[model samples]
Target chain A: MARTIIPFGPQHPVLPEPLHLKLVCEDEIVKEAIPALGYVHRGLEKLAEIRDFNQMIQVVERVCGICSMLHSQCYCQGIEEMMGVEIPERAKYLRTVWSELHRMHSHLLWLGLFADAFGFESLFMQFWRIRERIMDLNEATAGSRVIVSVNVVGGVRQDLTPEQCSWILTEVAQAGKEIKAIQSTMLSDYTVCKRTKGVAALTKEQAYELGAAGPTLRASGVAQDMRQLKYAAFDKIDFEPVVEYDGDCYARGVVRFREALQSIDIIRAAISGMPQGDISVPVKGNPEGEIITRVEQPRGECMYYMKGNGTKFLERVRIRTPTFANVPPLIAFMPGLELADVPVAVLSIDPCISCTER
Target chain B: MIENMKEITLDAVVGEASKMKSDGQRLVALSCTQLDADNFDIIYTFDKELVLTNFRVTVPKGSDCPSISGIYFAALLVENEIQDQFGIMFNGLVLDFGRTLYLDEEITTIPMCNNTKAMTVKK
Candidate 1:
């Protein structure tokens, strides 16, 4: 039997990541997928050698604009731990509030794109419309929509006022209700289920061994989430990893959909239990030695490895993004998939090539 | 700092990774940092029950570290990226990108290594 090698994309209709997959196929079914990345490689990690450590905070935020807050939060947390800076309690809650907002918007953005990937234009618009309200909240409260630059080494740079917090609560409550209205359409509709259910199914063992993270791992029933590490005000809130036993594309969709609504509750908790204190503290010295910090980003567990030499410049800053960790799992299950199913399956990982190549 | 990190020689990578696998650890991330012009510290992070166990292997520049892809299978992509970035090669890589994972054939400067310019295509 002869095998045909087909190029999937360096350009796709949807997905923020530009991935090129050389799909080896026997007729319509794929046998292996060899990925070619670096189309979006920015070498942001190497900036650590030149840029000052504090300046790198801004640099890391640009790694992935959608989850920029989580990126900076993870990086700053590692530096804070190294410098022994205990942030203010209010700062912790503020950070958690913004992180969940970013998570909700990120998940909604992904859901819209996922729907559009399969030609559900109407559903796409609905998800994005709901997402706009979250964006409005971010811009109104934090002064920006996409890359909310609220995180600093000691604490956050911005604080939510009483009226702003009240507005946010109202907005998110409405957003959660809107998400509930479309829950059946996104999850159980004939069109969505036909394309996603049982497509590119990955078992629990494969997902774990291949190093899947975030919802990709959770959708497979691993029950693992980096938020369990209790960074920020997550310790003060009640949370659980959303698990789906099917481990298919639809399960991945449900996890993100439910997480968007869950993000609403998390934001509510953070706002309600938030203490009154300073938003930031004074930092004394440079971070010395190496430390690794992990955070639950919209995609998955984002790890930051920072090494300081008692200087403004860090020796190295290695970022192992969720998409980077999730790629192997995506490739693991790609071999047995239909060529037509490749796009939906790849989008399922919520591939962020910039984060991966950075 | 690095907790639960056992220092090992380069050749012991596969053996240590195999042991971690048998213990039911998930291969999380492999971070490679240049110590100097001479060596790189390879940190293998594994998670079991949400607890991280790490193994550090210090390999001299241009040395061949045994590939853990055979054991973890997830080590393939990171191994290739390390191969491209630091100019360190992995023995028995499941899919060796031959230092072209991110770099083109024309630009040869090792990007992650110090004192060498990370070459980009003239666009």
Candidate 2:
């Protein structure tokens, strides 16, 4: 048997972002895959040195458009810990509400992209249609659809009043019902299950050893979610990580589908138990020490390590994105998969190249 | 939480990493911060049972730091990345891109280092 190398994409119909995979194949079976990134490497960490801490919030938020809110939230959390400022109670509740809404929209976006990857056009359209409602809510509340710059150092910039909260709750509930109606088809449809089930499977031990995070780790039955750290109002709210034991593509899909619905429930809970107070507090000085803040993003566990030097600028800002940790596992799973199944396995982890290269 | 961080020597990093691996701790992240022109601090974070333990090691410029990728294979990406962006040398990476993981050969200056010239802003 002879091995032939095939380049899988900096541009492909299935991938919305740039990720090049060099696949060594014997006929249609892949023997190895070597990934080449940096196509969209903007060097945001280096830029953090030039920009002050306040401006770096906007830069970090641009790390990934899909999970921009979480990126800023994680940065703000790190800064708040270093500055030693307690945000208002109302701010915590608002953060929780927006975080869940971000999760819902992100999962829906991934689901739509995953459907498109598998050639299920109608499913793609349906998922994106439901996702638009969340986007509209974001625009209405946060003033932006994708990169909502709502998170500030002390607290969030915007607040939702009672009328707006009611509207959001209604919208999320309707989205939940619609998602449930399509859940069986997305999970159990003959084409979807056949393409996804038992593909790119990783055991619990493998997932932990390989440093897999987020839904990818959850689908492998690891039950490790950074939300358990309870950074925001998660400690006050009732929550359990969504986990699936199978560790296959289908299991990952099931986890995200369930998580979207869970986000809806969480938003409702947080809004009903809303606290009355101010949304932000005044910050006096610069962050002087170092801290590591972890947030569970739509993809997985995103870690931010910030070291400050008692100035307006941070000495260092290192972001360990979920996609960066998830890439190695994707490489490990690729060697044993068929050439045709490569796209399915690749999309299973929901690779965000921008996040990986940022 | 600061008490949980254990500062270790560069020579002891490999041994300590192996112990954490045996204890079923996941490697949360690895970060490098430039201390000055001649020194850098490399921090390795690990998690188990929702508790974090950080191990720190300080190394001089151009020193060959022992790679923990052998114990935690996922360290390969971050190690390769640090090698590319910070010009830090890790002795034993499973997959060494030879400092081409994120940057090209034509770009010689390490972008993340303290002394590198700032990237020009296009007006």
Candidate 3:
């Protein structure tokens, strides 16, 4: 068995993010892996010191375009903690609605990419076409397709009008019905199951030991979702954290698909129950203290640490994204997997290198 | 319960730590900043539940804070990041701490520290 060293990315056909993994393969089986990060580090934490607290919201939103709303939400909560401000009821519901919408689109986009990676082109097209509804909702409400800077300290920047809310709910419900149909086909289809099930497997114990969070951890039978913390309006909504026990690519795919349904349910609840109140409150004084805020992004737990020295600019801002936590589990799962399955295996963790490196 | 969630500080956390391990609290993040020409502030976050306690310690010019890599493995890359961005060192990282971002062959000072000459390094 001659070992062949293959570089997976920094430029590869499958990855939508910049991550370099040196995969050592003995014939078709992976022997070992070494990951190289910092390729896309823009010194975001350093930049936060120079940017004012408000402007940094936009900066943090760019950490990863897919999870942009979550980043802004976490950042806003961190700043609010330091400043000791309470967001209005309406703002909380709006943030929850938008956050769930972002989750729906992100999971759909990943589903399409996963389908394309495994050469299921029709499924990929179907998911992305369905994703357009959520993207339109984002642009109409938040003013951007990718980096929706709706979150601000003490609340959100935009308010959802009644007409917009009604339209969004109708559109989202239709998208949800379509997603259920696609998911049923994906689950029952023999080719999709044969390609994914029992492949790139991580056992439940391994997942916990590696600190794998989000869907990867949930797929491995650990029902621990930071969403259980119920930040924003999740407590008021009816939803369950999707879980699967197999801990393979198929299980991960199932978890993500089911989670999208839960997101749809959350969006519907937020739309119907949204209260009328202020969207934002004026933040006063410098944040002289420290605050740690954690939110459940589309991928997993995204943590933020903020320290303010009573200044307009933050003294320091640190982000611990889900991709960072999931990388250890990814490295652990690489051994003994076939070379051809590497792309889907890596994608199974939903690597967002921008969020990881930032 | 609400008050317990608020007002998390060192004195309160130190009291809590006696019940936990010496470093039982999870290390959230480490940050280093240049206060003036030769002053530095290194802050570490220890969190349990929603409460976060911050430890801020200062070091003079050309000095570095003690590394907590022994306690938290994730601190390794963060130390490297702090070293690259602020020229601070964590004494026993046992890895290529700064090579991830800055690619200097043997330079010791942080590339982004105040009053430092620019290296062609991209951090």
Instruction: Give the best candidate by DockQ.
Output: 1
**lDDT for predicted candidate 3 compared with the true structure:** 0.78
lDDT for model 1, on a 0 to 1 scale?
A: 0.90
lDDT of 1 by residue, A265-354 (tens): 899999999999899999988989988889999999988888999999999999999999888888888988887788889999999889
Q: Can you write out model 2's per-residue Cα lDDT over A110-219, one digit (the tens) per residue? A: 99988988889999999999999999999999999988888999998999988999999999999999999998899889999999999999999999999999999999
Query: lDDT (CA) for every model shown?
Result: 0.90, 0.91, 0.78
lDDT of 3 by residue, B1-123 (tens): 012232233334334434333544545455566777787766665554435566566677666456555445545666677767776555666444344453344554454565574333433
Q: How many backbone clashes does candidate 2 have?
A: 1
What DockQ values do the models have?
0.80, 0.64, 0.20
Q: List, residue by residue over A1-358, the lDDT tens digit for candidate 3.
A: 7889999898888887778889999988899977877678776877866899989988999998999999999988778877779999899899999899999999999899999888899999999999999999999998998788898888988998899999998999999889988877778799899889988898986776555768998999977677777788877876777899999999999999999888888888888999988999988887777666789898988888677788898877878888887877788889988999989899999989888878
Candidate 3, pairs of clashing residues: B87-B110
- What RMSD does each model have against the real structure? 2.3, 3.1, 4.3
Residue B52 lDDT, candidate 3, scale 0-100: 53
Better candidate number, 2 or 3, judged by lDDT: 2
